[model samples]
Target: MPLSEHEQRMLEQMERALYAEDPKFATALEGSGLRVHTRRRVYQAVAGFLVGIALLMTGMVAKQILVGVVGFLVMLGCAVLAVTGWRKAGKPGEAQAQPSAGSGSRRQGRRKRSVMNRIEDRWQRRRDEQQ
Candidate 1:
């Protein structure tokens, strides 16, 4: 379920306070972890692709058909991996919203709920401590 208006306002207030207190840390937190992981995957895939090209060249020089076929397969696999990672990385500054009610699987919904519960618990604890 979406946050109520009051909760949204509270969250925004917390975010602004966090930013004001520690801009660097808040900036770091703004980046999605998934984006970082996908970027790393894309980089690795590109490196693998280069290795495949080298293997293909070596096979050509040695006149080994099997080696050349393997290299071609490697390149194809790496290309597919890179493309998928790029797609998943998404646009910079895009908000990573919660999955829609009808979109995600049951397992994902459970996981999201668990995470949110943890966050709520932490928030409650902080509020209690402050009081």
Candidate 2:
């Protein structure tokens, strides 16, 4: 579907507003960069667990549950990192700049599977198999 001319104009206006409100934020998002949440290897998770252990020990000695809780969070984060890596987590392809809902020429191409789509399919398949 193509965006109509009016839609394109509206989209541009919104973009202008965004730039006006936060030029730096808009600019910062303009380039290709490795997303900070990219996945890590299982070993990285192990490293996090180790750090958690040290923190836990300190927390135990100091009688500060907060310290231990933070360590636990680190450990959990590590696990999440490991899982994402194992699953080959990916970022979405560039959001196609369209001219609003009715404006502009519609670009056609293959869209990458979003992370949620991948996860959903996997879970759906697992569920079906168990039935």
Candidate 3:
């Protein structure tokens, strides 16, 4: 159903509020779905996977083990590429896999440590409960 006038106005107000509170986040969210490269990458990945499957079938029919192995590897790589592309597609404006000259690496390392610590703590708690 279409939103009522009051609901539309309320949504507009909320959007404005969100933008005012965190313009970067609002902009990122707005632009998340506008990545042409990501869509292309996904399409390429699908094509790569299909080509790999065809190569594998041909190799099997021709009794070429090396060709079949190469095709399997290509298929695996394409599958991983597609998954990563999908995950990163929502944040197209982000930089590539390079750390900035400043504290970017440190911040990422800290984030990783925090995540690992949380996982370790969870495991420890489970172990303690079991004991």
Indicate the residue-level lDDT of 10 in model 1.
100
For each candidate, what TM-score against the reference?
0.51, 0.35, 0.46
Each candidate's clash count: 0, 5, 0
Q: What is the C-alpha lDDT of each candidate?
A: 0.85, 0.66, 0.77
- Among residues 3 or more apart in sequence or in different chains, the pairs in candidate 2 whose N, CA or C atoms overlap within 3 Å are 3-102, 3-103, 3-104, 4-102, 4-103
RMSD of 3: 15.9
Superposition-based RMSD of candidate 1 using all C-alpha atoms, in angstroms:
7.4
Query: Residue 89 deviation, candidate 2, in Å?
Result: 8.8
lDDT of 1: 0.85
Candidate 3 Cα lDDT to native: 0.77
Off by over 4 Å in 2: 1-40, 89-131
User: Per-residue lDDT of 2-68 in model 2, one digit per residue for the tens?
Assistant: 4434556898898899899999998787543433344335567778878988898889899999998
- Model 3 agreement with the true structure over 43-84: per-residue lDDT tens digits: 899899999998899899999999998899899999999998
Query: Runs in model 1 with CA error above 4 Å?
Result: 1-31, 96-131
RMSD for each model, in Å, please? 7.4, 14.4, 15.9
Question: Which of the two, 1 or 2, has more lDDT?
Answer: 1
The CA lDDT at 96 in model 3 is 33
